[model samples]
Target: MFLPPRWLQKDSFPEATTFLAAELSDQFLKLLQEVGPQSNEAILVPASQSLALRSQLRTELSRPDDFSPLVLEGMLMTTVAQAGRSLSRRHHGKPPAWLSRAKELLQDFAGAPPSIEEIAHSAGVHPAHLSREFRRQFGCTPGEYGRQIRIQQAKLHLTKTRWPLSQISLQSGFSDQAHFSRTFKRYTGSTPLEYRRSFTSQ
Candidate 1:
């Protein structure tokens, strides 16, 4: 499961740990350094985004076509650059325990999520502090994270069931099919129908 280079092969992975690494060019490394926090500590990518990127890398690596390598590089570099922004030195270290509660509130919702103020009230933190820490620790605003969860839900529905877009939209917390399609396309770069078609065509 290890790739080339003595450094990359030196360490054994922990049990059940799914490790992923990409060798970056000097240009990309420089960009990452510039965009990333000025600290020497490791940058933390949020678990959900990390899992999504891992899945993408796995799929691209498994591809039997000529374009996989090029696509893989773009995907990895984009992930790195995007993750670098919120991982500042001040945001490092353990997040507050209540932050987990806040995340739970967002994730547990099946419809429109509660407002930021409500989430903060429920988590016993001030709205402003919750907003700041949520971005720092999770790499997204609470609202954005809620939207991401809904998108994940929508994708699951799209690939797993033959549900209509309107039904999936409501079930996934969108106001309507138009809103769902717009948000899904904004996040995924494809319409819901196109995304479903991809799975079918494959």
Candidate 2:
């Protein structure tokens, strides 16, 4: 485990919990809940904390005698990785074979992902086979689809909600208010306040 920098704990640790069990990814983050990813200015803890974590882990893992540092480090890394994969699976929450049929069925799917077995049944194939083909077709796992859906939902909330940023974030499936703010600014090039202002006062 990495030790956070003093700055990360400065005043109050705001963005720390959002990443408690999360993975850093390029397109999206697999947060514990249905929380969306954050953007620039979102990570308040500073890069120092991350650097410290790595350095600490590295230093500790360097010890061999009486430490079993290698084994412990390996386990820790593996666990973090597995958690990410698991969260991705859950976020995808899709059954590949059923997706097309679901598309036909749900109609308003709005690009949401289908479950694994669902995709298999819809494709008239087995789950394993369906997973391969679906990845080939989409350039990403079903998890990407769910991210798109959630991102779109966030967009809608930014456009529609008159509530507080945190409330809008929760209602729209983000991990927290700062996460929503960062993502909203990145995706739309505007803060939630600015985006909402664009709408009519209806």
Query: Model 2 shows how many backbone clashes?
Result: 17
The lDDT for every candidate, in the order shown, is 0.77, 0.50
Residue-by-residue lDDT tens digits, candidate 1, 1-202: 2122233245432123455667878777666666665434345565557668878888887774798878888887776666666665335677778998999889997665799899999999999999998887878889888988999999999999999999999999999999999999777657899889878876
- Clash statistics: count for each candidate: 0, 17
Model 2 poorest 10 in a row by lDDT:
37-46
Off by over 4 Å in 1: 1-82, 85-91
lDDT of 2 by residue, 1-202 (tens): 2221222433322122223333333323234123421221123221223444546656665665676645555544444444334434434545454555533433334333467677567657787866665554433455444554566777677666557778877766667889878866654446777667656443
Over 4 Å off in model 2, which ranges? Answer: 1-97, 101-131, 200-202
Q: Ten consecutive residues with minimal summed lDDT in candidate 1?
A: 1-10
Q: What TM-score against the true fold does each predicted structure earn?
A: 0.62, 0.36
